[model samples]
Target chain A: MTPSSGASARTQPLDHKEIVAAPRTLVLVGNPNVGKSVLFGALTGKYVTVSNYPGTTVEVTRGAAEIGGLRWHVLDTPGTNNLLPMSEDEQVTRDILLREPEYVCLQVCDAKNLRRGLLLACQLAEAGVPFTLALNMADEAAARGIRIDTDRLSGALGIDVVSTVAVQRTGLPLLLERIPEAGVSKFRPRYDAAIESALSELEPLLPAARLSRRSLGLMVLAGDDSLQPWLASGASAVRLERIEGIRRALASRYPESLRFVVARQRLAAADRLHDQVVTRGKASAGSALARRIGAWSTDPVKGIPVLLLVLAAAYLFVGVFGAKTLVDFLENTVFYDHVVPWTEAFLRFVVPAGAVQEFLVGPPGLPFRETSGFVIGKYGLVSMGLAYGMAIVLPIVATFFLSFSVLEDSGYLPRLAVMVNRVFKWMGLNGKAVLPMVLGLGCDTMATMTARIMETRKERVIVTLLLALAVPCSAQIAVIFAMLQGLSFAASLWFSAVIVLVLFLVGWLAARVIPGRGSDFVLELPPLRVPQLGNVLVKTLARMEWYLREALPLFVLGTLLLWVLDRTHMLGLVERAAAPVVVGILQLPEQSASAFILGFLRRDYAAAGLFQIYQPYMSTGTMTRVMEIQVTVALVTVTLFIPCIANFLMILKERGWKTGLAISAFVLPFAVGVGAAVNLLMRRFY
Target chain B: MPALVQRQERCPLCGMAFDAEGQGCRPSCPLATGCRVVCCPSCGYSFPQESGWAGKLKGWLDRRKEAGR
Candidate 1:
């Protein structure tokens, strides 16, 4: 029968009788965006219902087609990341397989992303599903330096396999002809003895259905909650209770999630299959540029120049464009020229003269009082907090986020990790830690949370300490860049050298002190592709929204705290107490002490305070090399100071209070000591 | 419905497909509707979710390649 006879027919769901009467049903399945729908459309013509699954909003489409003289019902299911459901769509896809056992599986896969596809294929094999593998996007895959030996993959899986460019409708006829050759995959995954025993126990309890008892048992072992309905339909109360007991017992054996353990095995199997069947080749002309860049990105010898280029670009974009250009316009032209003057005049008019107006906008005759401390004070909520958050930090972080999105989309971050892996080895960390370290530059709190990806507690602790101590967050980086951009490049270099030296010294010491060894880095590098601008813009906007939500309240709260401290006379006392260290040790101005104390509240806030004191000389329109050494020393000190309050809380949550407190205890004195040393040394040279 | 049929975005590093709505740093975020950072559900790598322009550009490139073929 010709499945491609016509495109005129509209798709309709097969009635129960027709589904039952059909010779066979071919179900199309794969991970999301693997061209399953396109393949389904190619085979079934225009007949389809691409809508939510029954009784749920997860998308699933079904249609009917004639194949090999038999009317076949086609079930186009939602893309499942894994065979066992992690989300609603995955759940719907899993349910379709369990409920419709008579269907033959037609697994569509992205040719360039074979490993992930094979992970699901392994699940299908374990489930005893008769299936054929279609490696879709064959052309695009070839362009991106990927090639798969289909016959080898077929031999390895003991199933029919075909490569198809589904969008172009190439290889469809051949794929159709091989549908009859579909069979239960011969490949079977081996599980640990505990998992095996658990499967056996569950096998006997499972009711006869479309799914294999082994598959169902594995799902049960993995703690799939959605399986309850299926179990309730056929399992007795006693049997269900026994299964739960078995599951709990199995779960108790491991500290980590058992699901990940099982997934790791499947991933290993997929890797082996990939090694046996896939090959890398030269990319086409369209992708040659991306391919070469992708290679250079991970190659240590070639990557340095690429990395430098990237850093220079970032500095120019965030420092010059965002911080200098945009911030100048917003702060000088918009806020200083319009908002501050307007707000001060309005407050002066509205509030009757006396203590209220004086306190609200700061006392008259106080220099910069119109812009400085209380809610309405010159440094108050609107002038200081809003101006800093909107005019300065926002543009810098927006540019940073945009750049980050570009790197992430181009698949360069992983390559950077690979290149940095050698250096990380000296710190007793594998390349995997690079992800969190890189993320720390964006937000240390988020990076600390992401530290869970590290296999060892020792690695996590070390990385956490490094993040809290040395990494200057995106906001802080913006402020530092804004401050230093006006000064000499030597100051920037000096600041960077100190941070890198301190990071290595601390990380090395932590590695020697920590009890455990780190695991080797084994990461897959993705093919490089052109970044999608709309996607980049979206990510930038989302990150900016997150920043605004997280930072604005803190800015306002910080202003309030400063006001309270000033009111309580505590600010003067603390400044006096800190004066000796600030003046003698660090050799910084007395006012710098306040910025150091505020640094604990928010790193960016402290940096903003520094910006107010040391902005580029207005007449020269540039920061003089004047006191450049002092500025560099101060920046380095703050960069290495104790974590911000938010970050400290995260450290406590992730690593417990003792470790958190210990990290802070160590970082504070170390930061001060380094600041003193840097100051003493710089004073001699500059 | 056609517009809802988004192009599949895969993590460049791990090769995992992204659920445009579900995966990423802030899934339930109010700003998530317009945000395109498609995080890999399997691996933690986040990549920008592709737009229609990318799809159209790819199609155009593919057509040119096909003509050469």
Candidate 2:
């Protein structure tokens, strides 16, 4: 029989010409790193270049293969954990399953990780997709002492199941023979009453697709927004609204989201199925040791010491090595000695010795001048902007990113979250808040958006407030390290203590003042492994590239703005205007006012400005006790200063304008007030 | 012709894997026009997308590793 003749036409009208021209498709779907690629290559006989699926950036590989004496188009989809479509890759994979006219799936599973594979299989069976199960990596599973009863699993699910080690081409002939006999399984997970009723109501409203209406209804009940396009294609507005109403009614019945409830039910069912069909024995010695370390890393008692050791190592690497050693070598030896002098001379010789030249480097004189620097001059783009970006900030962020990537790749971040769960509870947030809070160290703007993951608005608002007030981005932290490296250990301790104190104090207050309650923390921790060197380098390089592209220009712009203000004599006026705060209250020099002014544009810019100001005091070796106190005060104040423009705008976007404005209004004065108190108390004591 | 395929990125914080070119922030976002950061659709976590040269280098590394294996 022809392929199109048997193709189901319950969804959209089939394109006759297209169906006849296209070969029968066999899609391979599975979890990530499950040997799907190996299976696909074995099935298709060659690797194929991937191309983006239409209207998406998701790449799906298609290759021609002969299975059962029929030409088949083998499609290797992006690995996805769930068909409910959490991310774009998952969404695209689901769409292919829903929209493909005539296709059968080859559900690949890692024999060792049956539970994870079964989770996806349960969803596929519910979708009514005709598929055959290929439990790949059987050899590795046997080595690990994991055994699966394939016959029992097949009989339970009503589908053909084949065990194969794809690398060795085992069971290839059997898998091929079963492709022609692929049939939809009758397996369906029984959800709770509320979800079942909602699905029943939603099923009638959803349009027909390659997937069963029940499956589509489940996705709708899960709040999969990526399905909107597919749902809106031919469905009426009233039907969509009714479907939404049913979803809302069901969601209101539970304290948690419908998505969470649905996911939990599916996972519970997968666990039950797994227990029935699989038996586990002792794992290998290497994996057993890795498991022990992973457990210790998350233990409440043991994890604290691990966390501290990690922090100390990070400080030594990023603080002492990256910030001080690298910055001194690059800034003083490379730029000041060579690049700055050479660029200044070259610009002077190339251009006239007037406005353009002055703008390029800085004015000819040192102290004061009418003209501003552009490239090699005082405010010169190359000297101050590029130098700070490349010489000072680059090494620090590079080292931080490298360490962070190692932590991420080694799977310690989730453990870190687990360790911090209790402290987060005091702030009316769960451990999930740590993800955004920790991410704020990299970039507050992105972290503000990441606040969406928090279950409650109160939790999000508190996290956002704390991020703006106390959490300094990596660049600012780097500059803080640079500024404090010259002082005693007590100075660094004081800065850290003040920042931590403010975070906890404000978080405690916000919990009581905010209107909503917090949710329980439930996080999935991946198995910890050694960090991959290639992955770490790629991630570090990507982040360093981002700093150069997105942040470097802002540094130049901030410098140019300051230079223009100085040239117009406006900078001095602004400084004198704020003298009461700068000189009187804070006891900082009037010139330091520019740092505070530039602090609003970008926190790192202001910190860098302060670093420039503090350099002379350190280099001259005439630093007094009072000078050391001022440095700590300045760093503390800047760290607590207003969020940068990008982050501020994101705050408004995510938290609404009222809460955004209120957060800024509270943070600005609170930061200064704390700074004033610190200054007064430290001077009296020291 | 060279195949047109976008790289995939995973959010380190949440482990949400996504296409690097898909699931951008809203177009109304000021940074959306030329934004190079890949935002996670699942959790809203954002990270810088790899540059072309970095992507090439990674592909080359993976290929060499595969050959060695």
Candidate 3:
């Protein structure tokens, strides 16, 4: 999506010939996660990309619905704030609007937070688009006893207003019914006379314009870059210079950025409309709660303690419960005892020959040839994939997601973001970046993708570094849980101390070394509320559906690759090569290197290696507890050290390969060196 | 009790506000409105409202799926 100051506007109608022979198109636009997808689903039915993440629909999603024998083309856009865009997603929103569709715009807003979203609504209104305001999440406001007067709102804004709860499909059909009516009229901004005069003169210079002349004039007035192509295309060198001259002359009279001023005026218009339409209901319980919690979560004494408690709760849930309890239950009860054994025996029964059975289950004298099964064994990708999915990872994440949902819904997470903003800033990120960090703890794969929410590319890379190095998603957290399970609470303390110290030190260092920028913290802390049980459930389900859909296929592919490696004995060859690095440099056994490979496949698998081998050593006194701490630190560091494949791919996609490779080259050696030094120090310091 | 939370007697750590009639709705949930132990937005604070047990059931199901995968 185009950033507001950079995007040039070309007002153009969509070509009917280019479109399939469908009826006129209706486009839905809104701020992020304001139920645009749900509305699309409601209107178009069942087929929308109904995932829980923001920016999930990276492109405009088009669907069709037949109403009164006419097939309606529905375009659902990514969430965006202003007509002038920032962020890639916002630019996509601009592109869709640039293609003038026939149906009126379904300008959706979260009714509870009209003040923030209405800023965009006002921009669209000023852009002279034919539109209707689709008020969403009305039930949320109504629960606070807030009432909105739709008729009054429509009159004030000069557009149709439809109050809806998209999840319930509430007022959706009514909106579809009113689309044809709202399509007949258009709205435009009223700029000051000086600006209008300049716009009128400049409008004639823009070529092949699809928008109103005033809109192009305003964009030229805004000094947006999107107009660069349009300006450069037709004008000769001299004409282009003349047009550029006009842009500069006009930029001067409007000393206040034209974008910002235009936005403020438009927001004021929306505010005026809101004032006319919304009543000051009895003080909402939600608003009151927001005020109260806002004090404590922000105040240092109570806020810091509260923040600690939250971190502790999260650690316990994702680390201890998800990793230890769930992993043990699934790996022990389900996969190890029932599924794997059953599959091995079934293979023995069917294969009919000793070598084949051994090949299917295991080679000579191993309890079960891990390589033998058709579905999951060393050779079977599907079985192993399902086993890993259900057995090793599922239970822990269930508890983790449930707890995560509760925290998110209660509004504590946003407050936590504000509290940590200062510390994170030293790492070159703002408070808003904390959301991704918290998410990084649960799953860095998802968190890395979420870092795009940060305003700048530089901030995004910094967050990515911290996520790759310091944060351990639920899977790795579980491995940590298992390692320290029987160790003294003091071990837990030591383990945590080093990780936290590293998190801050590495973040500070990366921020300084990476030469990135950071934003000042001023987050919109949403009112804390009792998390809704139902909302959390559906939301969690949607998120899981998204995770499983993205994750399982990778697991299968990873397993298939592993099978190929094992079959060719290439794993043996690679293992031998990695063993020396593991033993000679990290001072661990050759076997430990395989854990790193597993770490790439599934996050915590590397840490699980320590669990299997190290327990016997410390218990037998050949290995000291201090040694355990050192290795644990190293494994944790390395596990958090490199970007997981999923996150790495996202970075390559978003930041491009040069940045992605540079990040990896820097982090890999840093992880290994940190591990070696921390090992050496623990042996000395303790 | 910050006045905002005290007027509503909610756990400020988790903001959960509801009108009087909306009482007794998410009784069993740890983050439910009346828990007042942490911040909680209302079931009403929802695009996907947890109107009843359906919400809790979904959360449970999601967790289970998460564990399995």
Candidate 4:
């Protein structure tokens, strides 16, 4: 599924006259991609760079702007569709709102897509935050023939409202005119009779804070424990009794869920307001084309073939195009032609001493190429760094990021999640856990972080283990695909079968160890759209920049660390110690020792280093050896290898060291056991 | 405090149907969309409405237990 990097509307730089003196705040709130950023830049006169949120797989941008004689803190929050935020991005937006600020929130709505945007607006209203209704993308609304009466909307909503094509700077004047007046306006969330009665009882007893008395009263009634800190110690006991009294009086008068009851109260009110002010002429976003594609992608009859096509696309892009084409140019033309020779000559010119020069430039050996291994400083540095950064890892990652961007943009990934839910349930994982697993195929590091979206600790651990054991990082996948590109179809077919069997088997086994009721995956499926190349490029470049910064140093540093270990003979000692499991369990040669050693440093980098060993000296026995080595290395390294430095830091921050280390411990021996069984079976068959 | 489990029959959240060894009781929720449920292991969100009753009873008993009653 191509990532829908949604269309970012054009931005115009601001002028001095638009700058306001008094400091105020304007918060942009809405559904995904209604040109909030475009409006944000236009408002603030600040270059709001796009980036992801910290410690999670989501992003937000905050900037400064001037509006209505006030300098405002303009924040473009993560696109949240409804009151309940499911994703990390959505959670961040909610988190921001929890921090009560002196600000006017502009709930930006796409005139063409107001129904979806209004859900979140209703949530803001329920929270009783002061906000203006921004009917953004007015041109699109005009095209779609959605006519909203602003005066009626304001009257119905009991707040200031304005329409604007935020991308085109259409309604800034009117929006600005209303901002000052929005300072103290209140949005009272309509609650059902029972909860309202309960709140009325609690409100007088409640202490004052940033949130409205009614809002806090309702939170106390609904039992949002995030409000726990401010409450008196016996607050829960008191609140529970009151809530129970209300419930007893009500006697299942509402639905089973307090959450749904809350939403229904707000939604009914929003719908009534919506009916008064807005008239929808036609559907703009959801088209016949979208339905056809969506149907083909998610359902069983056609989804299988579509899934295969996507996998095949990944193989072709990373293997055939990236590794075969781009790497060849960079490796052959750029590095070989210029960087290597110059670096060698420069080292000779400066270092003077032969050993010192060799340490810096060339490896200490006769054939020269033979000396280029992971342990020798220069050879290891040049080969591993250049290869990982520019040659092999880069283009593969670029294609990967590009494909992910397209899938994200197209909005097909949600459907894929729906389809995979059934298979996931069989493995004792709920369907909701499937997204991180599918995303696991892209980057295990990010997938691990994405696990927080799961409701339970048990689900997070299961998904984390599955990711570490089964999923190959895109870079490692590129090397494997390229290495096996020459193998017979039957051999490749066998290789594919083993991995699939292991994924299911391992997932099932892990699920048993950490069993719980998986969260219900009631996700909002955004309509699929054609991926804009502009969005794709920006998204791809940003991720590539991150991947490059993340992995490149680790590549070079891993080489240097290995070099030091080799020099100290610590590596040899460890390999000798690990030899029994490495050889006896996996049944491979001692020469494959270096690959195993490098695997901890970097998975794909290690695979690339290992590939050169046999690709040149290809023989019949070597094929079996290669397959064994690849499988054993892929499985064990994926699971057991110390998480590359980036993931380790996040694990510490999110789960703490004890849980993170625990995950690694379970992975190591389990990976080896799986590898041992596979090795024995393969040898027996042959 | 951890919440109550109203269901004495099959646990919908567990993805398990009614078992043969049924604890000599029945548990059901008419509001459940399906037999399967995503019960909060910690919070017991999947419990039948009887959980509200059970929770109150348990709290009273636990207070007695703590007081050596």
Candidate 5:
């Protein structure tokens, strides 16, 4: 049978004489954001009207235009990434192609990304559509040192190819002139013989449609269900069953999805076409600079120093500027010097002296008198919870988010993933896990959710366990640095060493135990462009908002729990219950038990509790060596403890209760065990 | 007309520096509609897309290139 004679004629072939006599429909089709609409406006001017495609919600714009004194109808279809009807929008584009086979297709493409555009061109070619390929945004390609030889590309495809900067109307005259000569691409994507035979069998049964029967058969073989409406309308049950049998026979031939197989063939054709016509020259100055930085960032040798500089810069900003400068001003000057006094006076005026007054303002003495603790007491909601949330944690989270956004915008995070892949491989994980691990520093709760990106359940569980046990959130880290900065730099070193050791030991053990294969390392290192200040500010503000929303209420709840524990005398009972572990083995003060317990509410809240203990040193002007060792042990234990309540709940949600509870069970005992060991070792050495 | 700036990003896997935001989604990806990740055109590895004013500025320059031509 001829190509057009079999089930291929889904619709009546347009009468050649009639098509030439009437006004032609020129359809503009492309991937999204590819300047299709701009070209539409430039070609048709003010003559466009948009309405939803019939039977679908996707809008298609139609207008009238005059090209070379011939009046033509122009239809600007919705942006479709593919012609295979993967979505309702794409289905509409495909439907239009099937309905009006005579319409001329103008395929607009991004000149900088030709392969993707060429993939669609391949699809159009298989459909037997007469089309012209317009390579848009030529200037961008040029700036990136990309030069596509349109003449050679045209020769390869045996179709007219015109390069146009549509926004500037550079090649409009030539493009318009070439449209009339549009012809089917001489190039075709070849499928396997089995698929070709299946197409022949299905072609006889398919009713006349605009798409070639071969393309329709390929869609059918690939299991596209979106064509059910059309199939139901035309095919008898016997024909449908035969088509299904053909599909099943084809499916048995491949181990992978036929869709993937077909796509691979098409892309291979695109790549071959690209190699013939595309050339790269020297990059422009800005792109060259970004490329150089991107190269240095992932180079194993150069990346080490770059990583150190980044860490140092983060410490200088968050620890020094944020915790020291911003926190000092907000807490000391704003809250302590003004707001506390104002709240006290207001409380004194509102209530008469009694038990009630004492509960609210703590007997009107020093802020930490430690009596009658409630709303205004030393550990009260206002005094400690709100102060810590707004004054201390806010600056820390703000600076951290600011720095993080810059790293993200500059595209350094993926390179970091590459650099760390080797180390991660030791733990049966790969570089891809680094995304969520870095994210865990911002907030373990969100990072636990992001662990879903890992390829296997085993990798997710390991990453989640590590994040819970070792990655201290930004607030906790900030408070740790602040507290340790006063004691000694070695204090911070001890804390880091202990956490790193715990992470590696646990990861190594878990990798051996976990039962799935880790995904291989693969990451895209985006160019290291200069981050825009505006984007960084917007992202920082967004993260700060998330911090306030997530952390503030937990702070208040933690403080209230503390107050209730004290009031019910449960605090003393628990402290006494853990006294042997708290004071005897760990060598921490009895009061330190309360901080460890509060850490279960929020890691940073517990860190803030430790901060309060060290604050008196500012006035006393000395940190005893014993206090330093105790502080170091406390920080390490808190860092390795079970994830905070929010993150625990997320783990339970994402990983299911069994694994989540198992992880929590493991971490609780492991953290204390490591803390006890660290205490003994440090005491012996220091 | 001024030369347009090409936002080239190198894929770590293949080292092809295509337009960072210009990569297209695979036909089968369900998240293709609103996902904020950019796929590498060469290797198909997805990374987070750059956001905010910088992406907007790059878009504006692309449009300017179209118009200037």
Candidate 6:
């Protein structure tokens, strides 16, 4: 049959009638974006039919091609990172593998990212699927100084392995010739004794399917609920219940999840195979320099200096220039000098002077307030909200985002993780925790969710706790930097030292208290390169936009809430109620109580409040020693304080109510106690 | 000839390429409904999906590369 004719007939669900009617199938499988479709196009020229897999949105494409003098039904399955399936697309891909009969698989892999590809390869091998490997993107791999010995790999896996650039049709003939020689790989990752025993017992209970019983058993062990349908179809309920019992029993034996243990073994096997066959050469000049710098940045001894240098640069740029210079120009020259006067004049002309005007701009000449008009009041939208969000926090965050983007785009962030891996070990976490922690610097709510990347619940909780307790988000950090600008370098050092100590102490304590094992760190580091200017700018702008959308509104809301409290005389009541902690313990002005109240809404908002209170002290360049100590204590306390409402909600969502509440319960008192202690210590020393 | 119809985005963090539209956030996430972040199915690394001028810039770059090729 012609390709289109075959495709038209076979594109629908492969029912029993069609399965019998169709020819033997050649299924294309691989990770997404690895040129699977391109390979499919190369195999079956010009005509194909695409249809959704029955009852699902996942599209499955089918066509016919003459390969090695035989008409083969070509099935292009969905791209999947894991055959076990995590998402709908991956589930569909796994389902195709489970359902298809008399099929030979063609596993397309990215040549540069061989380790990740081999993870799927290992899964296929475990499933006893007869497959041929195509290491696509050979040219890109070569460009990046990566080389693979296909012959050695083929020998190792006992299967055909061909290096091809599918887009260029580089090794099409060779791949075509090897298609008929596809064979089941003998490779099997060695699991732990407990898991092996469970698998051995479970295998006999499972009914035969396209995949081996051992593979099915492993899937069960990994808690892959997507396999429920296939398992239900084959195994008796009694057998399934017994399988669950075995899974639970095995799970209880290990501190970590069984899925992590299984994945770790597979990753270990892939790494060994990779080491055996892959070699590196000199890359292009730019990348070569980057590679050298990347190496130095991850080195134990050298990495410290590199990290310190980067930090100093960031401090000077963000703290000195952005906070001091940009903020001065914006706040003084832009807002105080021009915008405030123009806005007050405009509001006076537009609206009759009364409560509405006072509410909008704030009462004229209010005590301790900088400008006149309600909008320029202590809680005015224009004076406090817009000034803090646009002028003070914006410049600081923008600069931070710029520096952070450069670090991220240059591929230094992962290396920073590696450098800190030893320290993370103390916390029962691997270097992988750094990704979320680093992300916490951007936004803790997102980072709390990203903590799912950790292998164990223990590590996730620890990471989340650290994120909530100490890792101030970007805007908060910017405000902190601005606050610190008024203090001595020693004060900054004290704040850093205390936060670091708290992080390690809490992490160490939580690791011991929480019950689970940490996974081995096995992150694949991308080749370092100079940060692209366009990419950095795009990332920075994107982050700035996020701040504008997600955070700026909170500033306005906070100002409005504060304004209402002030107007209702509730501000005095609340300030008096919080006096013991804010004034007595933290030794801050009674006015700083409002900042603490606002801190719960958003950490940056509170910091900005303190910044507003400290502004007079900073601008005059005449901050008293007592004022310096108070600012230091307040900044440190806020940094270690309870996370903002959004992050708290996220923590509750991710960790569930009990753990989330427990975290908050511990953090609140701990933050106040730390602040108190710092108050006493700074008083004694400084 | 299988028609290549779907577009994919590679996760910069984990290098796992996925169909951005198909990879939904966890159902329980409060921000799930209207979140603009594209989460990696494999690694769970969430990043804002590129759009507007950023997307245009990337498209322009890709087209330039294609034209050169």
Q: Choose the strongest candidate by lDDT.
A: 6
Model 4: lDDT of residue A252: 61
What would the TM-scores of all predictions be? 0.62, 0.68, 0.59, 0.58, 0.63, 0.73
Q: Identify the CAPRI category of the predicted complex in candidate 2.
A: acceptable
- Residue A130, candidate 6: alpha-carbon lDDT: 95
Error of 6 at A467 (Å): 1.2
Give the per-residue lDDT of model 6 (tens digit) for A392-464.
Answer: 8788778887888788777787788878877898888977898888778777877787788776778889998
DockQ of each model vs. true complex: 0.19, 0.31, 0.06, 0.01, 0.06, 0.29
Residue-by-residue lDDT tens digits, candidate 4, A315-361: 68866787788877877777766665565556557776566656665
Q: Model 3 reaches what TM-score against the true structure?
A: 0.59
Candidate 5 residue lDDT tens string, A303-377: 899889988998899878987999889988998788766887788789888888877777765553364557667
lDDT at A562 for candidate 1?
A: 77
Candidate 4 runs further than 4 Å off: A1-113, A119-288, A300-302, A332-342, A345-353, A362-365, A372-379, A427-434, A486-491, A619-643, B1-69
The true-versus-predicted C-alpha distance at residue A27 of model 6, in Å, is 8.5
Docking class of 5: incorrect
> Relative to the true structure, how large is the alpha-carbon lDDT of every model?
0.75, 0.78, 0.62, 0.60, 0.75, 0.80
lDDT of 2 by residue, A108-188 (tens): 987877877898999999999999999988997786578899999999899999998988978777888887799999889
How far off is residue A562 in model 4, in Å? 2.2
Q: For model 1, how does the per-residue alpha-carbon lDDT over A324-438 read when each residue is reduced to its tens digit?
A: 8988899889987888768777887898878888777766655444334365564587678788778777877778778877877677877888788778878988677788787
RMSD of each: 11.1, 9.6, 13.8, 19.3, 11.5, 7.7
At residue A33, candidate 2 shows an lDDT of 64
Model 3 share of native interface contacts: 0.08
Determine the iRMS, in angstroms, of model 6: 2.9
Model 1 compared with the native: what TM-score? 0.62
TM-score (0 to 1) for chain A, all models?
A: 0.64, 0.66, 0.62, 0.63, 0.66, 0.72
Please rank every candidate by lDDT, starting with the best: 6, 2, 1, 5, 3, 4
TM-score for candidate 2, please give it. 0.68
Q: TM-score for model 5?
A: 0.63
- How many backbone clashes does every candidate have? 10, 11, 54, 16, 15, 6
Task: Give per-residue lDDT, candidate 5, residue A222.
Answer: 75
Off by over 4 Å in 3: A1-112, A117-146, A149-287, A363-366, A369-388, A486-494, A553-572, A615-630, B1-69
